[model samples]
Target: MPRGRPAGVPPIGSYTAVGDSFTEGVGDPGPGGWIGWADRLAALLADRHAEHAPPGSFRYANLAVRGRLLDRIVAEQVPRAVELAPELVTFCAGGNDILRPSGDPDLLAERFEQAVAALRAVVPTVMVCTGFDTRGVPVLGLLRGKIATYNAHIRAVADRYDCPVLDLWSLRAMRDRRAWSEDRLHLSTEGHVRVALRAAQVLGLTPPADPDQPWPPQARPLRSQVRRDNIHWAREHLVPWIGRRLRGESSGDDVLPKRPELVPLELPGAVEA
Candidate 1:
């Protein structure tokens, strides 16, 4: 059944996603490449709107590339999004900036405020996302305070502009290993689905599943096994990440946005990721 636009709901005919690996679908794989939460949310929004729009008129774009910093996203992607002038825009950058030791949360939020101000001027609805709680993760755990601080600043910015916020910090289910990819930095496929659902909830849309669905309890891992996993993660993922930093090379150094323009949404491109 085609869902009628709910009373008081903001009708989204078009949406443009802006961000880093999280929005770029770094961990979620589709035939097109990585299918992130942005694409999934686009699917949901499209379904709700397709019935009302002219055939194939409901459109979407994704300007996110992995490994992008907030400055670059604001400096490069933000202006382009403003030009596209979509009815809806999602802004979820600054995580890459948070990871840096010298990155200032206050300064990043200031830049973010400017970006949101620009988007809100032309866009009817602008959505933003918060950083995740990394207290249980290995290396990221150490930076939990910084992430929290940045998240606070983001929330304030969202409030100032009346923008909807997808809060990743309170998603307790995400602490589970199943929600994360092998790299430990990005979300797994399941995580992406959960986040998509959560984003829908934020937008006053009905999601098919609960983002906070409880996980089945299991026995605690043996300390030695945990040690082994840590060692393997360090070897397979951590070392290479460190190497990239030392060499000042980024994963997105040459990458481009998969979908740079607002077009009809394409989906279900499932691949054996």
Candidate 2:
């Protein structure tokens, strides 16, 4: 069954996905472009729930906006999410905070905590938070360090709020340069599928029927053009580890595992860059 819908709820269970471009599936084609992982996650959840849950027990709403910041989410998205009163709420945010010139890690964490707290007040069942993908950006050369700091903040917030988090930053895909788009920011189709699969495993839903299928036929040429160096990164480093966490097979570590080789590129004369 799909991930978010509660077992025994009506087939049309409601959900609200709040996040940035990654959640919006920015590069993906059409409205359903692989641009946002949230849509893919929603689809996976619905499809699986349809199959596994008794008839008519899955539905969701994607409220993710492109380029959204943590502050903006509190100002706009959270109120709507409260009104939706979804059975499940997934929060995928923080990339923009890391990208903005004036982004503050402390403020980002505070807002995230507030957002989760607000969401929980409305929907108590499931609240999923996502971390960043710190690979391939020239400006974000300190991506790994920044992500570690930010994820630490997120983990703290999750523990305080009693929510689940999906650590996309430490995933092997973020370490491998090939998993990123040519722009060196957004995810490629393969990256989207990997994220969806991971989310499925987390939500306890069946994996996509064909996990290897590319979203658009045109993406095939793009896929070929990019090197597939980190193709096994997700399977090797992320999947098994996160699978254990989701299944309650292991205790999750508060500190993110290190991948120094995957660290962001350093700029000359930059502090810890």
Candidate 3:
């Protein structure tokens, strides 16, 4: 554990990730159904802490569900995480809320701060995340203002609790079209890798590679192709998302956490950034 941690807080080794689709590995598929940045970051943390702990002792859990509301995360996931009391907790919420038509950043910030304060009380480290810079995303780009407002509050909450911020908004690599999946919502495989690399850096661990590595040069798609792709995207992804919202349904309606417990984590080519 680093020096000056609250006296009773546990040492750093175990980690728990909390949030929605982003942390749940929506866009990045792997050995399992999805392997998001949290899993990748866990592999890096395990490798770095290996010498200091027994084999298989570095544990990790991800309590994120897709399309979850920030209040639900606080009401359900937060308490469970507190019970587990892992040395490190990455509290990422509010993105789903920011997307709602009636989302209020200031109100969400109050709730977010409460969760962070509670987690910080028992966990040696509590990391927070900001929403992505949605300027280049399709429909989401229109709500960039809402996301930005939420991001600002997130930074303030992290600062108040002395927690580190995974400033996704500042990651310039995300602006590229290649960073997202066909839905133009969740990240693509490359996007998850970039996020993981950035997260490792945020945790003060040496990243295996650069988060902002340049993509190979390629010709832009034809204007006609862009129009077809947009139409296809609306039918396949966007329309369904809107329907779900209208019906008050979610992609993760009853989905369980990918990794519900802080057990030993298996390291494989699963997280080669």
Best lDDT among the predictions, by candidate number:
1
For model 3, the stretches where C-alpha displacement exceeds 4 angstroms are 1-11
Native-to-model Cα distance after best TM-score fit, residue 120 in candidate 2, in Å: 0.5
Error of 1 at 243 (Å): 1.4
lDDT of 3 at 47: 81
| Clashing residue pairs found in predicted model 1 | none
Candidate 2 displacement at residue 118 in angstroms = 0.5
- Please give, for residues 5-78, the per-residue lDDT of candidate 1 as tens digits: 34676568899999999999999987769898899988888877866776566799999999999999998899
In angstroms, give how far residue 152 of model 2 lies from its true place.
0.4
**Quality of model 1 by C-alpha lDDT:** 0.87
Clashing pairs in 3: none
Q: Write the per-residue lDDT of candidate 3 for residues 158-177, one digit (tens) a residue.
A: 77888878889989899889
| TM-scores, each model vs. reference | 0.94, 0.67, 0.94
lDDT, each prediction: 0.87, 0.59, 0.86
Task: Give model 3's TM-score versus the native structure.
Answer: 0.94
Better of 1 and 2 by lDDT: 1
- The lowest-lDDT stretch of 10 consecutive residues in candidate 3 is 1-10
